[model samples]
Target: MTAADFQIDDREGGSVLRLTGDWTTTGLGSGARDLQARLGEGRVTALDVSELGRFDTAGALTLVQATTEALPKDAWASRPEAGRIYAMVETLERQSAPPPRRPDALTRTFAKIGRGVFDIGHEMLLSMAFLGRLTTATGGALRRPGSIRWPAWFSQGERAGLDAMPIVAVTNFFIGAVIAFLGANLLTQFGAGVFTVQLVAVATLRELAVLITAILLAGRSASSFAAEIGSMRMNQEVDAMQVMGVNPFQALVIPRLAAMIIMLPLLTFIGMLAGFLGGMLVTWSQLSYGPSFFIQRISEDPMMGTHLMVGMVKAPVFAVVIAAIGCRQGMSVAGDVESLGRRVTAAVVQAIFAIILLDAVFALIFLELNL
Candidate 1:
């Protein structure tokens, strides 16, 4: 093997390139690469390869790359034997066309927005379809009450609702305390520090308790449902159930949905009490207001019932959204660990978004109602 020779002969037009030596890996690969770079600029209009010594795939690739770079003109090997190797590489290259270049930033941004809108619409349709299926399953169960799985309902309720009590309680407690502290801090500036107790009670009972609890459940129970069902799907257990003349919707999904629907309100009620208790603690510690005064203040507030009712009413909807999204994503999981993980994550994201969207809609409705 000898060193690669890249001799350029300038003419009135462009130039002629004489590619000599081995051009193989054992030969001057560095020289070939350098030659490739020099010839890449479209300066070489012709190629001569009669003197090309040792040849291999490596040599063929280097030559192929060079000749490809020499566009608007063909770079033919002077010797016929080497022409076959070049032709083979050229054929392969031609068969596999280069990918199109990435779109510009502006085009990509618009495309991304369009895709996002489409995805939202698609998911909404899927969710509605899933809801319809679930409703049908529920109606079937109602017709034959004995077919309803009470054990599964109890088990799911325990896992999703009962087991989540401590975290929900403690979390809302602190949240309430923080809200009271903030209210006191701000209202004190206007000589309305006493209204801090009112603020905590209203917010805790009306919005904070239910909203935070739903968010927690979305992260916790929703993820659990997605993972559990997703795993079953991955293992083909869901498929096995269907094969056995069993309804996955009744056995797997309905119980979870019922549990969430049942548990969310219960949890919300628990959370509201906890938050109010926390606010009570903060009120007493920070402002020296006693429990009796706090209780009396809450009783005197006319909007308290309206606010409490408003927040509680949203729980069932939030529950259905969260459970449905979790189950839907789970059912959609492909037979792979990565797919399961991805679906579980998507379930959480979609559940949270739905919860927030529902809350905002509730707020608007209540605002219009003047509640």
Candidate 2:
């Protein structure tokens, strides 16, 4: 390869660089070092690479290494050609690597178990810390309830309740229909078709409604809480609050948690009603069961109230879990968009897991009580 000819000149805001002919390793290195030196002196902000040149990997590597090393870590590079340099490096790194060794089945199983235990421990510790902080802040707020921010509570309520109603309504309606259809099909075979009404009512009021509502709140409200708080963290708003002598947990977390705790029960109730109505439609229209007969069957079932009560009780607990997980994950977020994304995802996953675990606990308690 022939040596490249290049020219550097002062521009209106930064340096202008032009290249001509073929770029040899030495020529490329010289040009890259010069640019690096200019950047070190804080004199260069842009480069003009539009001039004619025939370059190989050495030339590309020189540009890539210089750009990567010279610029401030946060500085943006908008060069299209420079992308090729990074891509080539990445491709080479991947292609030159050996295939990963697969673990034996027992090793993989043990690794998974170990990871699960670690994750559970980490989550528990974080949750305990968050709850401790929340309790401290809440006690302080209770001492001066008038000092508690009302606007924040209203905003959170609106977001967690009104904004989430439509989707919750649609989903619960479909879920009710599905349950009724499945029960009707199975029970009809046993000449117990009339029991479908009790099945739909008890299950919808006690389990499906609350569970579905909790999951929706986890996905929608919890994720939103995490993302909002994470953004505040990234923007240093939480630090600013601290500097201003504001309690972030009281101002942020309490309001959100309170809103969720209050609204979730109400939403679950609404979901239960919608689900029951959907089941009623299927039973009365498709199954030819009269509305009176459905209502009578539900009322006559002694265990119906037990299921309803179980579901209703689960709602508040689920809300608490969802809010706590979201707030904890959000507070843990580092100052980056990527960290925010990860924490938001974690919030949803953790909230759902916690909800399911709590439901299981409730189920065991109810079983023990013979309810």
Candidate 1, superposed: residue stretches over 4 Å from native: 1-22, 25-28, 37-54, 68-84, 94-107
63-108: candidate 2 lDDT, tens digit per residue:
4544433322222244455445546754564457788999999999
* Local distance difference test, each candidate: 0.87, 0.81
lDDT of 2 at 92: 69
Note the clash tally of each candidate.
Answer: 0, 0
Best by TM-score: 1
Q: Give candidate 1's root-mean-square deviation (CA, Å).
A: 3.9
- For candidate 1, the TM-score is 0.85
Q: Compared with the true structure, what per-residue lDDT tens digits does model 1 show for residues 1-371?
A: 58766677887667787778876678865767776677555565677766768666677677667665423234453456566666776677667778999999999999999999999898789888988898899999999999999999999999999999999999999999999999988998998999998899889887899999999999998899999999999899999999999999999999999999999999999999999999999889988999999999999988899889998999999999889989999998998999989989999998899899988998898899988
| C-alpha RMSD values across all candidates | 3.9, 13.2
